[model samples]
Target: MTKGYIHIYTGDGKGKTTAAIGLAIRAVGAGKKVCILQFMKSLAYSEQKILQSIPGITLITLGKPYFIAKEGMLTDEQRKTWGNHIRIYPAGHPPKDYREMTLKGIEQAIDAVSKNYDMVILDEYNMARWYDLATEEETEKILKARRPEVELIFTGRNAPKEILDAADLITEMKKIRHYYDKGVPVRTGIEN
Candidate 1:
């Protein structure tokens, strides 16, 4: 039997979640089942529509509606536009609802790895740990308990060293340049 290794996509750049989604699609296309447990995000992005359309894919989002940002990270325009929905000041202590959602996501991920899916993708999991929404030890325990044939993918920035050391393949997506510097809002089908 072929061994399915653990993979991680981490760094400051984008495309980590996108890459995991691509792999999930490939697995489903090859007649394998995929389960995506999204942490710290609940917005139904454009990709969610397509994921719902995919037959062998199960996508679950356990996150709050608002995105977390540092106090000074939001530009004046952004503050004025999305001030109501944004969370600023001390990104470490996320809202109780978000924490609850992320904990639920971790539980789902554990279940997915143990008995449900051929491939399990923990989207934005690193950030979940960084934000105190999840714990590295609990997640690692799940990884160790997963079936040998199950493929596991963890995506996010600032991945803990413990996770990197456990993963068989680690790819860091470095950010060289981004259109956000050019004053471009996230487009519906593109960045969203």
Candidate 2:
């Protein structure tokens, strides 16, 4: 059997989840079964709609309707506009329900890795761990559950050193410049 390696797409830039989805399409095109578990994300993303209909792909999303932001990640006006749709929490103190949900997603991830999938993508999982919604040990458990022939991918920012150490391939999406800096809100087809 062919060996499958671990890949991590991380950093403060955008396109982490996009890269994972691209890979999923490539894998499916190659006649491989792919499973994607989107952590800390709801079905609000337009890609979720298309990903669900693709052959040889299974998509699972585990998140609340609202999104989470760290304190100071947005301006007062931005927060006001996103009020009720965004939860801004301090470091090391994520919302309890979100944490519970992440743990449950981890279980589902473990199950997916143990199955017959050729590739499994844990989208936004690094950010979930960075936000303290999940633990390194729990992430490692999902890593350990993977079959030898199943490729694993994790995407999001601030990936812990432990995760970087375990990865066979790591691609960091550095943000040299972004239109969002000029106050461009997330566009539906591009960012959301």
**Reference-based lDDT, each prediction:** 0.85, 0.92
| TM-score for candidate 2 | 0.93
Worst 10 residues of 2 by lDDT: 65-74
Local accuracy of candidate 1 as per-residue lDDT tens digits, 69-128:
656667899888886887765656667777777777777888888896899999889988
Q: Could you tell me every candidate's TM-score relative to the true structure? A: 0.90, 0.93
How close to the true structure is residue 191 of candidate 1, measured as C-alpha lDDT?
Answer: 77
Which regions of candidate 1 are displaced past 4 Å?
70-81, 89-92
Positional deviation of residue 138's Cα in model 1 after best superposition, in angstroms: 2.2
Clash list (residue pairs), candidate 2: none
Candidate 2's residue-wise lDDT over 29-107, tens digit each?
9999999999989889999999999999999998999878878789999899988899999988888899999888999
Off by over 4 Å in 2: 70-78
